[model samples]
Target: MADSPGSGAAFPSQSPRTKKYSLTEEKIFYMNCRAAYLTVFKSSLENIISKDQLYLVLQHAGRNPSQKTINKYWTSQTAKLNFDDFCVILRKEKPTSKADLLKSFRQLDVNDDGSILHTDLYKFLTKRGEKMTREEVNAIINLPDVNADGKFDYIKFCKLYMTTNEQCLKTILGKLEVDSKLKCQQFGSHIEGTLERDPSPVPKPSPRVIRKTNQEMFSNKGGSRSPLLSSTRNFKTSVSLTITMSANSNQNPKLTEPNLIEDWQCVQSKGCFFLEEDGKIISHQYRMHIPEKSMVYLTIKPLKLSQVEGKPSPWLSVDTALYILVENESQANLQPLCFTELQNREVFGWTGELGPGIYWLIPSTTGCRLKKERKPVPEEALLVYRDETGKLFLTKEFRSALSDIFEVIDLDGNGLLSLEEYNFFELRASGEKCDEDAWAVCRENFDTKKNELTRQGFMELNMMEASDQGGDPRDLWVILHSMGYNKALELTEACPFVINIHAEKCKPRIKAVCMEACNGQLEKTICKYVLTNGSAKSMDGYENIIIYTYKHDSWITSVIENKLDNKLIIHVNNELSKNCVNNKGLNTYVVEVAPKSTMVCQHVMPLNERQEWIYHFLSSIKWT
Candidate 1:
C-alpha cells in the first residue's frame, strides 16, 4: 500500500483498551462535528449542501480549511449533497460548536473576567474596521447589559453576535428579492405581450384569493407573487373607474385634459363675450361662486391659443402668463388684482375679500398691462359676482372704532386686550352694568387665562357673525353694540390716558403716587404693579428715573420725560432730585422717590380696596 500522510509516523501496537478508547473518541468527534455544523449553519442533517454551507461549518469548527478543498467535495455533479456527505468529505473530527464562539468572546473580554468591558468591545470593533465614537460604543454596550454596568456577559455576547448575523442575512436577502421582482415584472410584461398576439381567444384564469399572513407578505420569496404586482393590478382598476366616473360627471371634459381650456362661444353676439348667469365664462373655461361678500374662491383653467384668437390655432404651451381683472363696482373701473404665469398645475385658485358690486373676472395672457388698454379678449370673461353686496359694509368703521377702544384700555401696552381690560370696556359700554353671560362666552372662546384676544381673532369673529346674518351690516352692528361698543367713541374720548413703563422703574413710583394720592395712607392701601415683562427679581434697589437731553431731535425721550415729570410732581421735589442725580454734559436723570409695595411678582397684579384711586392716578399719566 502507498504511504499515507500520517502512515510514516510512529504508532504503538493496538491493544484491547486502546482500541475501545479510539472507538469512543471517533464517536465523540462525529457528534461534535454534527452539533457544530447544525448550530452554526442552522441546517438539518438531510438538507442539500453548497460551498457556502461548507465554509460556515468549517468556520464554526475553528478550522481554516482551503476553499478549493471545500468546493471539490461539496460542489459535485449531484448539484446538492446531504449534510452527512458534507461531513464525510470535510473530516468529522472537530471541536465543540460553542468553543469557537467562546474563543471570540474571550478575545473581546481581554481581562479574562468572563464579562467584556465597553473598552474591550470598542477595541474589538475597531480591530474589525468598525470605527465608532465612545458614546456609540457605550450605547451599544448598554443595550445587552441589562444591569447597565457597561459590560456584556457570555450569554449576552453570544446573543448580540447571533442577532447581528440574522439582521445581516435579512438585509442581503431583501436586496436579492427586490432585484428578482424587477426582473420578474419585466418578464411578465413580455409574456403578456406574446399571449395577446395569439389568434385564438384564451380563457382567463380565475384569481386565487390567497390570505397571506403578515410574515408572508413581508418575507423574501423568490417564487411567490410580489406586493408590487398586486398593487399594479389595483392601480389599473382604480384608473378605469376614475375615467368612467369623470366621463359622467358635470365638470367640463376639456378640464380633465392636461394643459387644455374649455372652448366657450358668445351667447348673444358674434364677437362680444359675457359671463353666464351661473358664474362661468362663455366657454366654461373659468368658474367661481361667491357665497359671501368678504371672500370668493375662483378656479381658472389653462387657456388655449385657439380660445384667445377666436379661430383655429395651434395648442399653446402650458407655461403662459395669466392675469385677473377685477371691475370694482364702487369705482366703476377695472383693476388687476393679481397675475401669475400658468404652469402644469391642476387648478389656479384665488381666495380673498373683495368689495361689494358686479365684478368681472377677465383672464388675459398679457398680464395687468392689458387692463390699462381697456381691451377685452375675444373669448367672453366670467363674472365673479352679479349684483352682489357685502354684508359687512361698515367693516372699516367697526374695526377703527374697536381698535381705538382697545388701545385706550390696553394699559400694559402688550398689543392684546386682557379680561380685566375687557371688563372695564364692557362697563363703559353698558354704563357700569356687568354682563356676566357675554363675558362667559368671551372667556370660553378666547381663554383669557391662557391667552389674550388678538386683532385677527376680533376681525374673524366679526366676519363670522356677518356671514351668519346673510352679510347684513345691521346684524354686525347689533352684535358689536351687545358687546358694549355702541358708545365706544364717547367712552374712548372720556377715558383717562394710561402710561407704560418698565416695572422696575414704575414700582417705586407707583408706591409714591399712592401715598401722595391717598393722603399718606400708603400702609392702609394695597398697591400692586402689573409687571408686563414677567421678571422674577424684586425692583427694590432699582430707581425709576427719566433722562432728559438737550438734543431737540430726542423728541421721543423728551416726551416720555415730560409725562413722568408731570405724574411725579407731587412725589418728587428739587432737593430729592438733586440727591439722586446723574447729570452728564447733555443728559440729566430726573429721579422720583416712592415706597416699594410688598406683593408677589406676577404678570397681572391687582390693587385691592383702593382700585379706583390707583387707576385714576396711573391713568392720569401719559404714554409716548
Candidate 2:
C-alpha cells in the first residue's frame, strides 16, 4: 500500500517538465524535498532519495549546486530518487529565496566582513550549509545579541535565517494547505472538538501478548543473501474515521450513501490501507446491503482546519501498517485497529457475527503480518546465508528485485492484481490468506486478466514459485525479506535495527505486528474467538522448524514455518513489556529460513491507540 497520495506515481504536482514550475515554485521545490525528507529519512529512510540526501538538500537550501549539477539528476534512468523523483529533481529546483539566503551569507562572508568567526559560523553551519546540529549551532550561539566575544552579524545572521525561513515556509505551507483540503474532499472531515459521550470509554490499551525465544544471531555461510549485514520521535499520524451505523430493531439498516462517514475521510495512519479511494466511489467501496441486524459506529478523529481549504498534498504519508477493513466471516479476525483516545475520538471496536448482513468498514494497512515460538536447532541458523548458486536462479539482481516487488504490490497502478492486492502480497509472504481457491490458483496458473494478477503474471508467478521450490529460494526469500530486501538485492526503507533512540522515560515505536512467518500462518485474528481455525492445539516444535504465537488485543502477531530440508536459521525474540522495540521487525531478530517457507516475523503495535503495549515473543533455531 505504498503509492496513493492520489498517485501520479505517488506525487505529481505537474509535468511536461513540471509545467515550467510555479505552483509557488512547485510548492517551494516540493517543500525543500520535504525538508530533505525529514532531514534524510524521516522514520529513518526508504522511499529512496539519495545523492547524499540531494546534496544535503542543496547544501541546506543555499543551493551550492554542482557535482556536475548533481550529475544531471543521476540518470541512467534516474538511479535513485523516489518521492516523485525527490520532488522533481529531474529538472526544476530553484526556491531558496531571500535572495538565495543572502547569496549564501555572502559566500560565507570570507572577509567581505559582515561578520564570521566561531570557526567560520561552524563551517558555515556545519560543513558548508544546513547540516546544523550541535543543538543547532548551540541555538545560534545562544542567540540574544549573539557573541560575548565570539562574533556575529553577517547582515544580522542573514536576516536570522530569513526570518526563520519565511515563517517556516508559511508554517509548512499552512500545514500542507490543510493536508490539501482533507485530501481533496468529496466529503467527511470534522475534528476541533465535539465527540462527547462517554459513560465508560477510555479503557482499551492492554495488548502485548507474545511468547517465543532463546535468542541468537550468527550470519556467515558465504551465503544466506550476503553475510548478514545489519542495521525515532517518529510522530507522524493521520486519523479520520466516522463510520456510524445503528440498526437492530426500529429499521434503517440500508442507507448505502446517506453517510459512509460523509464520504469517508482520513484513516491514514501513514502505512495506508484505509482503502476508500479518492475516485469519488465505485469499486473503491461504499457498501450497505443488510437484510437484518446492524450496529456499526466508528468516530475516530484528528484533522479539521476547514477540511484543508485548498487541497494539494501528494505522496508524503507512509510509515507502514494502518488498517480498518471490517470484512468478517471471521478467520482469526483480521486485525490492526488499536487506536484508543476516548472522549475526543480514536477508539475502534468489534462485536459478533450473528448474521443478516451489514459489514462495510474499510480501512487497511494490509493486515500487518503476525507471529510464534519454539526451541532446538537453537544454535546454528544465524542471519545472512549467501546461496552463491545453491540455486534459485532469476538473477538480473533477482529480476530487479522482482520488479520492485511488483511496484509494491500494484496498489492501483492498473497493471493488475487486486484480490485486495494479492491478499496484501499473500500476507507479507505467506502467513496465510490468499483464498478464493488460492486466488483461483493464482488465476489458473498465472497471467490472469479480469481475475486480475498480471505484471507478466507477477513475474511468471515468482518464476513459477522459484521453480516449484526445486530451485528453492525459500519462496523467494519469503517475498524478499518481508518487503525490504537486501543482499545488495537492494531496497531499503532504511532504519530498523536499533536506530539509537533514547527516550528514557518514554517514546520509541515501529511494530504494527511486524512480519515474520513460518508454518501455515493465519491465527492472530484477534485470538480466533478462543482458537479454532487451525487449532491443532500442540504438536511440540520439530518437523522442519516452526514457531507459533498469535495473541492480540493490542500487540503480538508472528508466524514462521519452514518445513526444513535445508536453508534454516531463525532467532526472533521481541520481549514485549515496558516495550523497547528497535525495529527490523521488533527487537533482537535474525532471520533466514526458506526450505518450505512461511514468514512474518514481527509487527508489534503501539505508537498510538493511546500507547501501552506489553507484547511478547521469543524463538530459537539454527542448524544447517
Candidate 3:
C-alpha cells in the first residue's frame, strides 16, 4: 500500500521563513500559472484543472500537512515541485472546511471578480505578461458553458474543473514512476543531458537477472565505511505527535514534559486536542485498534461541506477491518477479520476466534468514532466479503487499500473468473494498477484451482475500480451480466474479482431418462438417449445410460458408473444427441455438454440459448 496518510514529514506552520510568504502565495502561484496558460491559449481556465491534477494536488503529492499550517499558508503554497517534492505534498493535511476552500478560491481570482475573466486570470500566470485573445475566451466559453450564458460563473467553472480534475488525478495516481508526460515536459531535457554524459540509458531490469551491484550498494556491510552509508547517516531529525487519552483533567501534557521523546506540544481543542507535528499538511490518516470481536459502532463528522476543491474529500476510510477470532487465538495472526467485513456498519456485534489483540478500523468520507460494547467468547467466527470491502479498501487508513487488486478475478463469484472477468478491472484507468502490459502480465501470474492472485493483479483491478467506474466493482454489474453472469456484486471486502453473480442460463436439468457420456472437459462427444417430454414416455424396447471419467496423478482413474433406468435424462452435448440419431419410434434421445457445474462440483447441464444464464439457478430444481 502507499504510505499511510499520517506517515509523511511535517512542515512546521510557524517556521520563520513561511511567515514571509503570505498564505495566498501557493494558490496565487498555481492560479497564476493556470492563468498564464489560459491567457496564452486565449481559453477559459476550465481545462486547466484536470482530475489527475486535482487528485495529485489533493494528495498534496501524497504528503499530509497539518490543518494549522494549511489554514496559515494554504493560499501561498505553490503546486510546482520537483518530482521528489511533489511526493512530499501527499502527506500534508487536507483543508477540511468551506472557509478554507473559499480562501483558496479567492487567491485564484486575483481580481476578486467572483469570476476568473481571461484577462484577470492572467495576472498570476507567468507568461511574461502575454495576453489572451478575445476569440480564445469565446471558444472556451462556447464548449464548456452548457447554459450558453454570456459569461463564466461558478457552476460552469466547477463542471469544467471536475471533469478535467478527474482525468488528471487518474493519470497521476496510475503512475508507478514519474509521469511520462510530466517527465517529457519537465525532465526530458535533463534525461537527455544524462544520456549525453553516459551515451547509454540505464538498461531495464529483467526478472531473471538480479542487479547485484545495486543490491550490494544498498546492503549494510557490518562495520564498513562507505560513501553510501555516509550519505545515509546524514539525515535531519523528525518527531511524532502522540496522544494518550487519559481520564484525569490535571494530567494534560506539555511540550516540555520529560516524557516527550523530542519537541512536541498539545492543544485543548473541541475535537481532537491531540499533539501535531509542526508542518504544512498535504494529506493524513489515523488508524487505531479496537479490541477483537468487540461490538463496533462508528459515525463520521463532516470535515468539509463543499466540493469547491477538485478531489473527493480527503477524510476517508480504510478497506478492511479486523475481527480476530479470539477463541482460536492462533488464527488471529492472519488479521483474519479484515476491514472488508466491518466497513458498512455504524454498529454491529461480531463473534469469532478473536484472538487477544488490537484490530484497526477505517471509515469512509469521514473519520470513525468507535465504541466497543461486546465481549468475545463462544460464537463461531464467520468471515464476510462484500460490497463494503470495496469502499473500505480505497481509504489510506486501511493497510489493504490495494487488496482489491489481487482478489480472485471471478466477477460472478463462481469460484473462477476467466480472462474476460480479469480484464474488467485492467481496461479502466491506464497505469495505476499495472504497466500497460497488465493483461499479459496477470495471465502469466495467476492460479487456477485456488484462484489465487498477486500484487500485480490487485493493482490492475484497483486502477480499474478507482477510475471510470464508481471506484466500486459493484458498478461493473452491467459488465458482469454482459459476460454471462447475473447480479454481479463485489467479492470479499478487499477483493475486486472475487464477485458474486448468477448465470442467466445455469445448469441443465434431467426431467426424464436419457443416455449421455462426457470426457474430463465435458465436451459431450456421445449420447445414447435424451429426454424430450416431462417423462421418458415409453422407451419401449430401448435402454439408455450416462458415463464420465477422469485420470488421477499417479495411476488410478476415477470413473462415474450409472445405468439407464429410463427414469430421467437431460441431453447436454449436441454431439451426444447426434450419436443417438434417428431412433424415431425407437425413442430418440438428445444430449449436450456444457461447462455448467454445481457448487459441490457436480457436472450439471449448461444453459441453452433460450434460457437466461445463471450460476446457481438449479437451486430450485428437485433432485433424487
Candidate 4:
C-alpha cells in the first residue's frame, strides 16, 4: 500500500501516517533515517553531502526523484547539505517507529558505552567500507561533543542535532550568497537557471533594498574594523559565514551587518580587545554604545623582554598585572581608571564612556594599594599614558630609576636589602669602585646598622639627594664618594643624577694623595673629600683629610692636603709626618688645631689658626 522506502515515488500516504505518530516517534524516525544515511553514504554527518548522496537520500525519504529532477533541485538550492540539514530533511520525511530508531542507534554504538566515541564511530565506518581520515572522524564526534570532552552524550547529541539544523542552514545560505556575489563580480554574468529554480521558498527583497543593505553591512561606521575580518575581500567562498542573512530570515533588520555582530561576539568570547592598525577597536562591542558620547576602548599587550629597551629587571613576567589610570586634567594626582590582572601572554582591554575632556590615561604594572598607609612613593613609580587623540604620552617627572635599581638588586623581593644585596646593587650601579669605604658611608649615613636597607630607606636616600638644597646632584656624588661608594657615585652620576663627575680621572690623584699622606698604609686609612671653594674666606671651605689608624701600632693620623695646590700641608698625630718634619728640614709650624691642642704643619696649610685641628683627630672623631 505504501511506496517502498527507497522507491523514487512521492509519499502519498505520509500526511495521514505522520498524524498518527507522536513527537517522540517522529524524532525516532528522523534519527533512524539519519543513521541509515550516514551508514549508507559512508561519510561523516558534518561533511558536505554530494549530489548523488542527496538523490539517494531523497529516494529513501519517498520523495521520488529522477536524476534530472535531483540535479535541478541540488543546483537550485545549496550544492551540498551538511548533516544538520540532512537531519531536517529526514524529519520532513516522517518516522516509522521508535523501535527502528533505537535499533539504528544501537548499530552505530557498537561498543555500547552509553555514548559514542570517535574511535567507536571510526571503527563502525571502517567496517562499512567507509574511507575517512582521523580528522573527518574527529569532526563528526565534535558535532555532538557540546562539552568538547572528545565524546558525545546520547541525549545532548540528539537535542543539539535537531536544534542546530536551522543555524547550519543559515550558514550554508550565507555562504551561497557570498559565492554568488563573488561569481557575479568576477564573471559579470549570473548563472541563468540556477537562482530562478531554487526549491526553498525564501522571498527576495527589491534590488534597491538589497543594495541599501549591502552598503550598510560593508560601511565602516566610526568604529575600528575587526582584525579577523580585516581582509574581508579575500574570504573563501565556502568559509563559515558568521554574518546573519537578511533574505527571508527572522533576524533583526538593524543588526544585519556581519562585522559588527561578529566583532562583538569575538570580544565577548575572548574577554579581551585587540586594536587594528588604525588604532580602532578590533572586536568592537555595539551593545556598549553610549548616547552622545564615544567609548574609549583600551588594550594593552604584554611585551617580551626583548621588546623593552633598558628593562630594569628580569622579575617582570608575562602575567604581570597591568592598569590604566584616568585622572582629570585639573587634578594634581593620578587616579586609576581601570585595571586588568591577566594571565601570561594575555591581552587586556576596557571600554569606558566619557564626555570630551582632557583625561590622563596613565598605565602601571605596580600594584600600588590606594590605602593611606600603602601609597606608592611617587619617585619610584613609572607612569605612562595616552591622550584623547590617541597620541602616546608619559610623565617625564615621575622617575622609576630608584625603583628599577632597587628591584634589580632586591633578589629576594622582601622589600629589604641585606648588605650583600646592597653591595651587589652598588656594584651594578656604580661598578667595582663601590668598595668597603662606600658601603661604610652608606651604612653610616642611612643608619643601615643591621646590614639591611628597606625600600623606604632607599627611596628616602634617593629623594634627599635628588632634592638637595644646592640642586646639584653631584653633591650626592661627592657624599657617596667620600663614603667610599666611588662606583655608586659614578653610577648615580650617570643614571639618575646624570652628572659628569670625572671619577675615573680623579681616582689616581685621590689615591696618590691618600698614599702619600698615609705613608702607603692606604688599607688602614679612611679618606673623605669635600668639593668646595677651598679659600679660607669661603664659608664652605673644608680640609681634604684622611683619617688613618694603624692596626699594628695603635697609631692614629690625620692627613690634610691643600685642595688648590695638591700640597701635603699638615698631618695630625702621624709619627711618619712628624719624624719626616723633625729629621728633614721640612718647613713647619706649631699650630693650635683645637681648643686645647696644637699641631706642627707646613706654613702653606689652607687653615685659619682657630681651625688648625689636632693630628690625633681620628682618636677623638665622632661616630656621627
Give per-residue CA lDDT, model 4, range 13-118, as digits (tens).
2111122222344334433444344434543323445777777666444443445555533555355665434544443333334454355556666567656665
- Quote the lDDT for 164 in model 2: 67
Candidate 1 lDDT tens digits, 461-494: 4556666666545644433433323232111002
Task: Please write out the lDDT profile of model 3 over residues 176-223, one tens digit for every residue.
Answer: 124443222211001100101111223322212322343543353332
lDDT of each: 0.32, 0.39, 0.26, 0.32
lDDT of 2: 0.39
Against the true structure, candidate 3 has what lDDT? Answer: 0.26
Native-to-model Cα distance after best TM-score fit, residue 69 in candidate 3, in Å = 31
lDDT of 1: 0.32
Clashes of each: 2, 66, 109, 13
Report the lDDT tens digits of candidate 2 across residue range 498-574: 01111111222211222322112222332232222222212234544444444433344455656656765444433
List the candidate 3 regions with Cα displacement exceeding 4 Å.
1-23, 42-404, 408-417, 429-446, 450-624
Residue 395 miss distance in model 1 (angstroms): 2.2
* Predicted structure 3, TM vs. truth: 0.18
Best by lDDT: 2
How far is each candidate from the true structure, as Cα RMSD in Å?
Answer: 41.4, 27.5, 33.4, 41.4
Single out the weakest 10-residue window by summed lDDT for candidate 4: 507-516
Q: Model 4: what TM-score?
A: 0.16
Q: Where is model 2 more than 4 Å wrong at Cα?
A: 1-58, 61-349, 353-360, 364-456, 460-624
Better of 1 and 3 by lDDT: 1
